[model samples]
Target: MKDKIQSFFHLEEHGTNIQTEIIAGITTFVTIAYILVVNPSILGDGGMDPGAVFTATAVTAAFGTCLMALSTNYPFILAPGMGLNAFMIYTVVLSMGYTWEVALAAFFVEGLIFLVIALTNIREVVLDAIPLSLKFAITAGIGLFITLIGLKNAGIVVDSPSTLITIFPFHSSMQDGSFATGGISALLGLVGIVITALLMIHNVKGNILLGILITWALGLVCQLAGVYVPDPAAGYGSLIPDFSRGLSVPSMALTFMKMDFSQVFSVGFATVVIAYLFTNISETFGALVGSASKAGVLQEDGKFPRFKNALVAQSVGVLTAAVTGTSATTSVVECAAGIAAGGKTGLTSLVTGIMFLISLLLSPIFLAIPSFATAPALVIVGFLMISSLLAIDFSDMSEAMPAFICLFTIPFTYSIVEGMALGFISYVVINTLGGTERRKKVSVAMYVIALLFVAKYFFV
Candidate 1:
């Protein structure tokens, strides 16, 4: 009976035992944990403290995810996500100059919008209305962005003269004063991915998880050895970027809210939200499928999920994140890693939850985990994501164009929402005016999707 349940999500086949699942879970946790530190850094520059924001994200991740794990039979985790956080900082703070409080207000407002749309089942309609190619393109675009982030963080690429970025920065040596001996992110990310790929080719068990662990350890060693990484300046305290700033309920809610949300749309809020929705959906899909696959609990057809139940848990998660004082509606990618790690029940999430709850008391300890250490994992993960591009149907314009647009726009534009919006609009326009297609009855709803896309581009 237990095996059957696990198999329902396709977990037993992949995730295997408790030990393997735990490792995967931890790896996933490590991959995204830096947000606790980095988010505060990004948001704090706008006047929020470094420590408080990080703590808020960490606490929400631990507590919100625990709620998710406890509430559902499915395996998933909750955390403030890449796109949303970036949106809040870049589009909201930098582009709009909103305080953390005003930002938090917008976040909560967005959560409300999300809840309404999701409950209305508009999620399915919009997803369906989005051209499949566009989805692929958006997915690919995010993959490129993730890859670029990894590469940049690894010091593989640096500020160049001609282009926005360059493959090599220093003439003969790295920025940190080392020759070939440094550049651990590049070395580990490239080498680790190759090794993992080979192991995968050989059908080795837990190759992905193994490769991540090995690279993580190696990166840490390099950090300690005074390799290519630069030491902090005279008064540098927390090196990895802290989440403590701007995370208090009052700070995030009041500070972020002071900014006019009217400006959110002006600063590409629509674009940001649209892109964020795509990434969030992607993470959720992957986590759901991967967990089920690893546990051997996935349905055979791979159709619908436990939508209503899952949404209930997810809704609570978004709300909790705002209350805790951070970004909104960030569904974690690591939850799938946990599900893969023999997390038969929510016990695995429970463990992670307790760890997070405990972290509030020991925020300083978490602050010490260097982001450079995690950069390798992200780069490797980006490599893994690129594999999805092959799944796109090149022959179908409806599919191919959207896919290509989404793939190209995200990294190039440094904006996920822009890519998604373009893809969505392109899909509708192309299908409606392709002239080569058989005439069929078009729905008023389809036209609505198209018009909204136009609004996103010109009106907003």
Candidate 2:
């Protein structure tokens, strides 16, 4: 059974090993759960009803991932997306006040563009032409930015209307010396217990995810029972998503077409394309490597296009959203949590897809998980994200300063792209002025991306 399942996941990296496959699969799901939630929350930034959008998220996640599984034997999961969601909502929608339909129309168009990129081999050209180190930095840097946003949203960081930014407060409602404080403290204690047990107690393989799951389960149980555990405010309810009646793409499509398409093209194809393409590259690459490693589908040369197919299918997902009446991008990492629970191969994804298809009957199930429960998960993810900074070439102040600036700017500015833009821009300036001979083939790509960031933020 173990060998068969191992073969099914295709976890042969440089070489195949079942034990490694198990570890990779579990870790990938753990990471993916957070990634899934990443896009949804960012998409929620626009003025859409979180409830309705969550429903859309469920549907798109189901359909898109199923298509990927069917189209490819690889295990990369698909869903609404992350960077694009933020680009659309916080940047495009919030900045311009565009209609959801228009924003989605832009998304659909971008998806088509993505398909063009994927089908025409531009995808591999870009990925191959890009330097692995820069890509690594971008991925990790994005991770840091993501963590900061999560922390900021959770009130781990508070903004000062005057001086710019500040940390947690000394006293307030959430800060009161009440049962709430005690409860969170207790929860922290439990988390400590989890860390301790994983590190010190048991010899279990996936202890990290297990700790997170136990916390999630406990948090959910308390919230559902209305048990006012630590944070009463951190409650998650089974709010239903009313998508009854078979499927109604016509109505959804009409609503979608009415959205703004002007900003998409007018915003300069270069900038949008980079954000869209690079976002797809980084996000899908992460998912593919993760799912492939977990699924054991790696070829001898590490060729795994399951991610490409999954991502390519996402262009269709964007179209589906336009017709499905939702503002989401792709599957939430919590979906991966379900995968982590004994899911193997495309079968795990198919089951998840089915569950998503039948989500209307279980919108409550989706709503049952609260942010506070996921808070620790996000916090842990943030830590993981920030840790990637360790790879930055810190020996030189030029490389170190810009990377550090980008790292810090995320939580302070409350934006990932902004941080990335600033980081890339800063990297260019520093490298140019400092005359660092050490670089890669992708530096030009970095410069191209950096220029786009400048235009998007300043000019646009």
Candidate 3:
């Protein structure tokens, strides 16, 4: 069995083994498992059944991840993306005053468009056309973006009206005798970061996974000692899992095949489809390049192996998600945690998919893993990815300028597509104006992509 598994995954060929892949998979799962709780909560706000959305979220993640694993042999995992879901509910449904069903239909159309693009190799062409420096920049940019996510989730960073963003007030008091949830969580998050850093300094195996577990254990301890009190209204609940909801699999009846296509021919629907398609394409492309770069899997020509298969898998995932009562499923940046933990091939992805399926019956336990616990791993992985910046040609202004733009814009704007779009525009324009030699070096696809982005901003 072990030999067959090794041969199937080409484990040895990838310089990895089953054990390392398993650990990497678990680490990836731990970091991303929050989606199981978060996705349903967000969709529920839009009148979708939370129970059904929970089921869809897991099913979509499992199906897309496993399909990608089988087809592409890459470790990148797929899930309903955060920003895409927000746009679906807030922008498409609430703001536009459309039913959730219409939003799903719009996403369905977007998926069809993407599948066509994937099958025709258009998506692959665009990915291949991106400059190598921008690829590295995307990788590093994603690193910072996820790091900011970690810090924000753990309460180490908080919103500020005057400054826009600021550190959480670690010394605030609770007026009504409740715990200072934000402050304590931030303190614990900092402690977790320190613990993870210490583990890294010692060269401990599976340090990222250990950091999450140890941080969670500490939270549990604090809860027991009355140091960290549970206040659901305050957004700092208990660390304990509530098995009162039972371990049965959630029914998907409410959300299954619920798309409403009556509005498909409307002009507003076209805008929504265009928006979804663009976001899905750009975000998925960025994630794929970033993960491949981090995993050292990008070919010498700057194209990733099985690129078409990966896109086809993601597009299929998006279609499935639309029918299953969720938003577009795309490659997640969190998979970088798995790559950082030494995942090199599809075997790692396979394990993550299985874990998502298992969460169907064990949702409470998985949901019990707090955000702060995983925050440290993200922060550390972010640092690991930023190391790619060292390889960029900083002395060349044309390359360095776009790279710098992409690197900062990703985290600042909180949008991967926006960052990549601006970077591509900068890359093409800067090179075209540099000299005749530089203009000759730029690809026709790059020029086309840049122009499309400009048109999107202006007209769309």
lDDT of each: 0.57, 0.54, 0.81
Q: Which lDDT tens digits does candidate 3 get at residues 24-53? A: 888888767767765665576589987788
Residues 1-460, candidate 1, lDDT per residue (tens digit)? 7565355434455445555545655645644555554455445545666566766777778876777666664556677765566556554465544555656655655566666666777766645554445545655566677667656555566677678787643446555654434344556656765776686678555455455556556655665675645445511223332456533222334332233456454534554444455555555555555655664555778654565555556666666666666776555655654554456555566566666665566565445544443354455556666677887888876668766776787677765665666666666667667665611323465566556657766665
Give me candidate 2's TM-score against the actual structure. Answer: 0.70
Q: Compared with the true structure, what per-residue lDDT tens digits does model 2 show for residues 1-460?
A: 8666546545353243544434434444444443333334455546655556666666677787677656664344566654456556654466445556566666666667767776776777667644443445555655655544544544455468986656555355355654343344335334534462554245444443455456556654554565444444543233222346434321223333454566666654345445555656665666566656655556778886455676667667666765555543443333344344434455455544665555445444333344433445445554554555666667867667776766666445545456566777877777776654744322676777777777776666
Error of 2 at 441 (Å): 3.8
Q: What TM value does model 3 have? A: 0.72
Instruction: Kindly report which residue stretches of model 2 are placed more than 4 angstroms away from their true locations once superposed.
Output: 1-42, 81-88, 91-103, 161-258, 268-273, 305-311, 321-344, 390-402, 432-447
Span of ten consecutive residues with least summed lDDT in model 2: 248-257
Per-candidate TM-score against the hidden true structure: 0.73, 0.70, 0.72
